[model samples]
Target: MNSTAVSVDRNRTLKMIAREFYHGLTSLLFPAICIVCDQRIDEPNTVVCHNCWSDLKVLSTDIVKMKQIPEQLDTILPVFEFNDTIQKIIHGLKYSGYKSSGVHLGRLMAAQLPQDFLLKDTVLMPVPLHPLKKRERGYNQSMYIARGIAEISGNIIRDNVLNRVKNTVTQTHLDAHERHANMQNAFAVNRSCDLSGIYSIVLIDDVFTTGATMNAAATVLKSRGVASIRGLTVAAPI
Candidate 1:
């Protein structure tokens, strides 16, 4: 009934219409194609087709539970195996800047998760990227993944709570011990963050390798009074 409320509604409607028009125009001019299969896809937001998506192997609950959990984390939830189609997808998301793909992968993970996997009031947080790495990458790939999970699960996201203070060398080539050492003192709780009523958090990432990154981040979160901390990723090695 108020003029301000009506104006806000009008603006929201205009934005939806504009978004639809842009999608329609882009789809018409350059139809979306599946990256894995190279088949034309109607969905503009995703680069991989449904068939290719299904090609990713789901990790059994036993494997997920048995995976080496960092001492600082309460649990680890890995949805898919880090091989084949998923490997290609993560490669594109991390190396080629296909952030939408990361989001899609997170959506897939949330959809496939068991009914009682995530605890109530569990906030989702992406592992922080160092300032230098973030500048070079333009965006944090795990943030988009967390965004997708939030979209599907209706969970809150807290991106500013954890901060990456150390810009260590990439762990891709590092052995297990090397990775553990590389991530030491890499993260710290944000100085202004008050962990008052927040009890649980799930750190999101694209893959679970040695879990060195999650371990480092969780150590910082636990030290800051977060009661429950867990790790969730799209894929993990068998």
Candidate 2:
């Protein structure tokens, strides 16, 4: 090889070595543990250990009914039952800032979709957090999950297409009726975006509780001329 080409190759190799060494030091200082089982994770960018991941209980392939789902939502698909393991994984991602957790869960969520779930022109939209809440959390867990789904499914993630106009109270302690009330009119579509070619949308969220939030998001999209809207979530109450 020419001198210049040889120099470039040497630089590339040195850079790769430095990057791996940095990652190795980081891992040693802050070991990655399985979100579910608390076992040490040797593989990079993995949330759950191999055993816990395999032990995760996937809901049956059949579509399950969601209580209080909005009429605007054509379907709601949840990958796992809201069991202890799933709960911890979600809590880590949503509250603990373990962002890598979303990648595994999101891929599982995408894998659970039906063979024809996403149409050719389907867009993935994550449920938006109110600006203040987003600021407090430092990140939107749903958006990260949607990104993971996009990574696996090759679907476009249109996060800006929807906006949460209302800063509602947390729904964690709310009853079914209270949740519906709190989420009413919480979302609206961004009028500036040209969604002309999008045939369908898969609304993404971290969890499906009373379905109030997902339904409210779907309502906004329907009002903005979206025809078909579906919901995808990591876990739901069984």
Estimate the TM-score for candidate 2. 0.85
Candidate 1 per-residue lDDT, tens place, 135-179, comes to 998999999999888889989899989989999998999998999
Q: After TM-score superposition, what is the CA distance of residue 119 in candidate 1 from its true location, in Å?
A: 3.2
lDDT of each: 0.89, 0.84
Which tens-of-lDDT digit does each residue in 1-238 have in candidate 2?
9999999999999999999999889999999888788889887777778877677687765536534466678988887888888888888898899887787778877787777987667999989999999999999999889888888889988988888999998899999899888999999888798877777999999888778998999988887788899898888777
RMSD of 2: 3.4
Error of 2 at 209 (Å): 1.3
TM-score of each model, in listed order: 0.84, 0.85
Count of backbone clashes, every candidate in sequence: 0, 0
* Number of the top-ranking candidate, with lDDT as the measure: 1
Report the C-alpha displacement of residue 12, candidate 1, in angstroms.
Answer: 21
Window of ten residues with lowest summed lDDT in model 2: 61-70
Badly placed stretches (over 4 Å) of model 1 are: 1-31
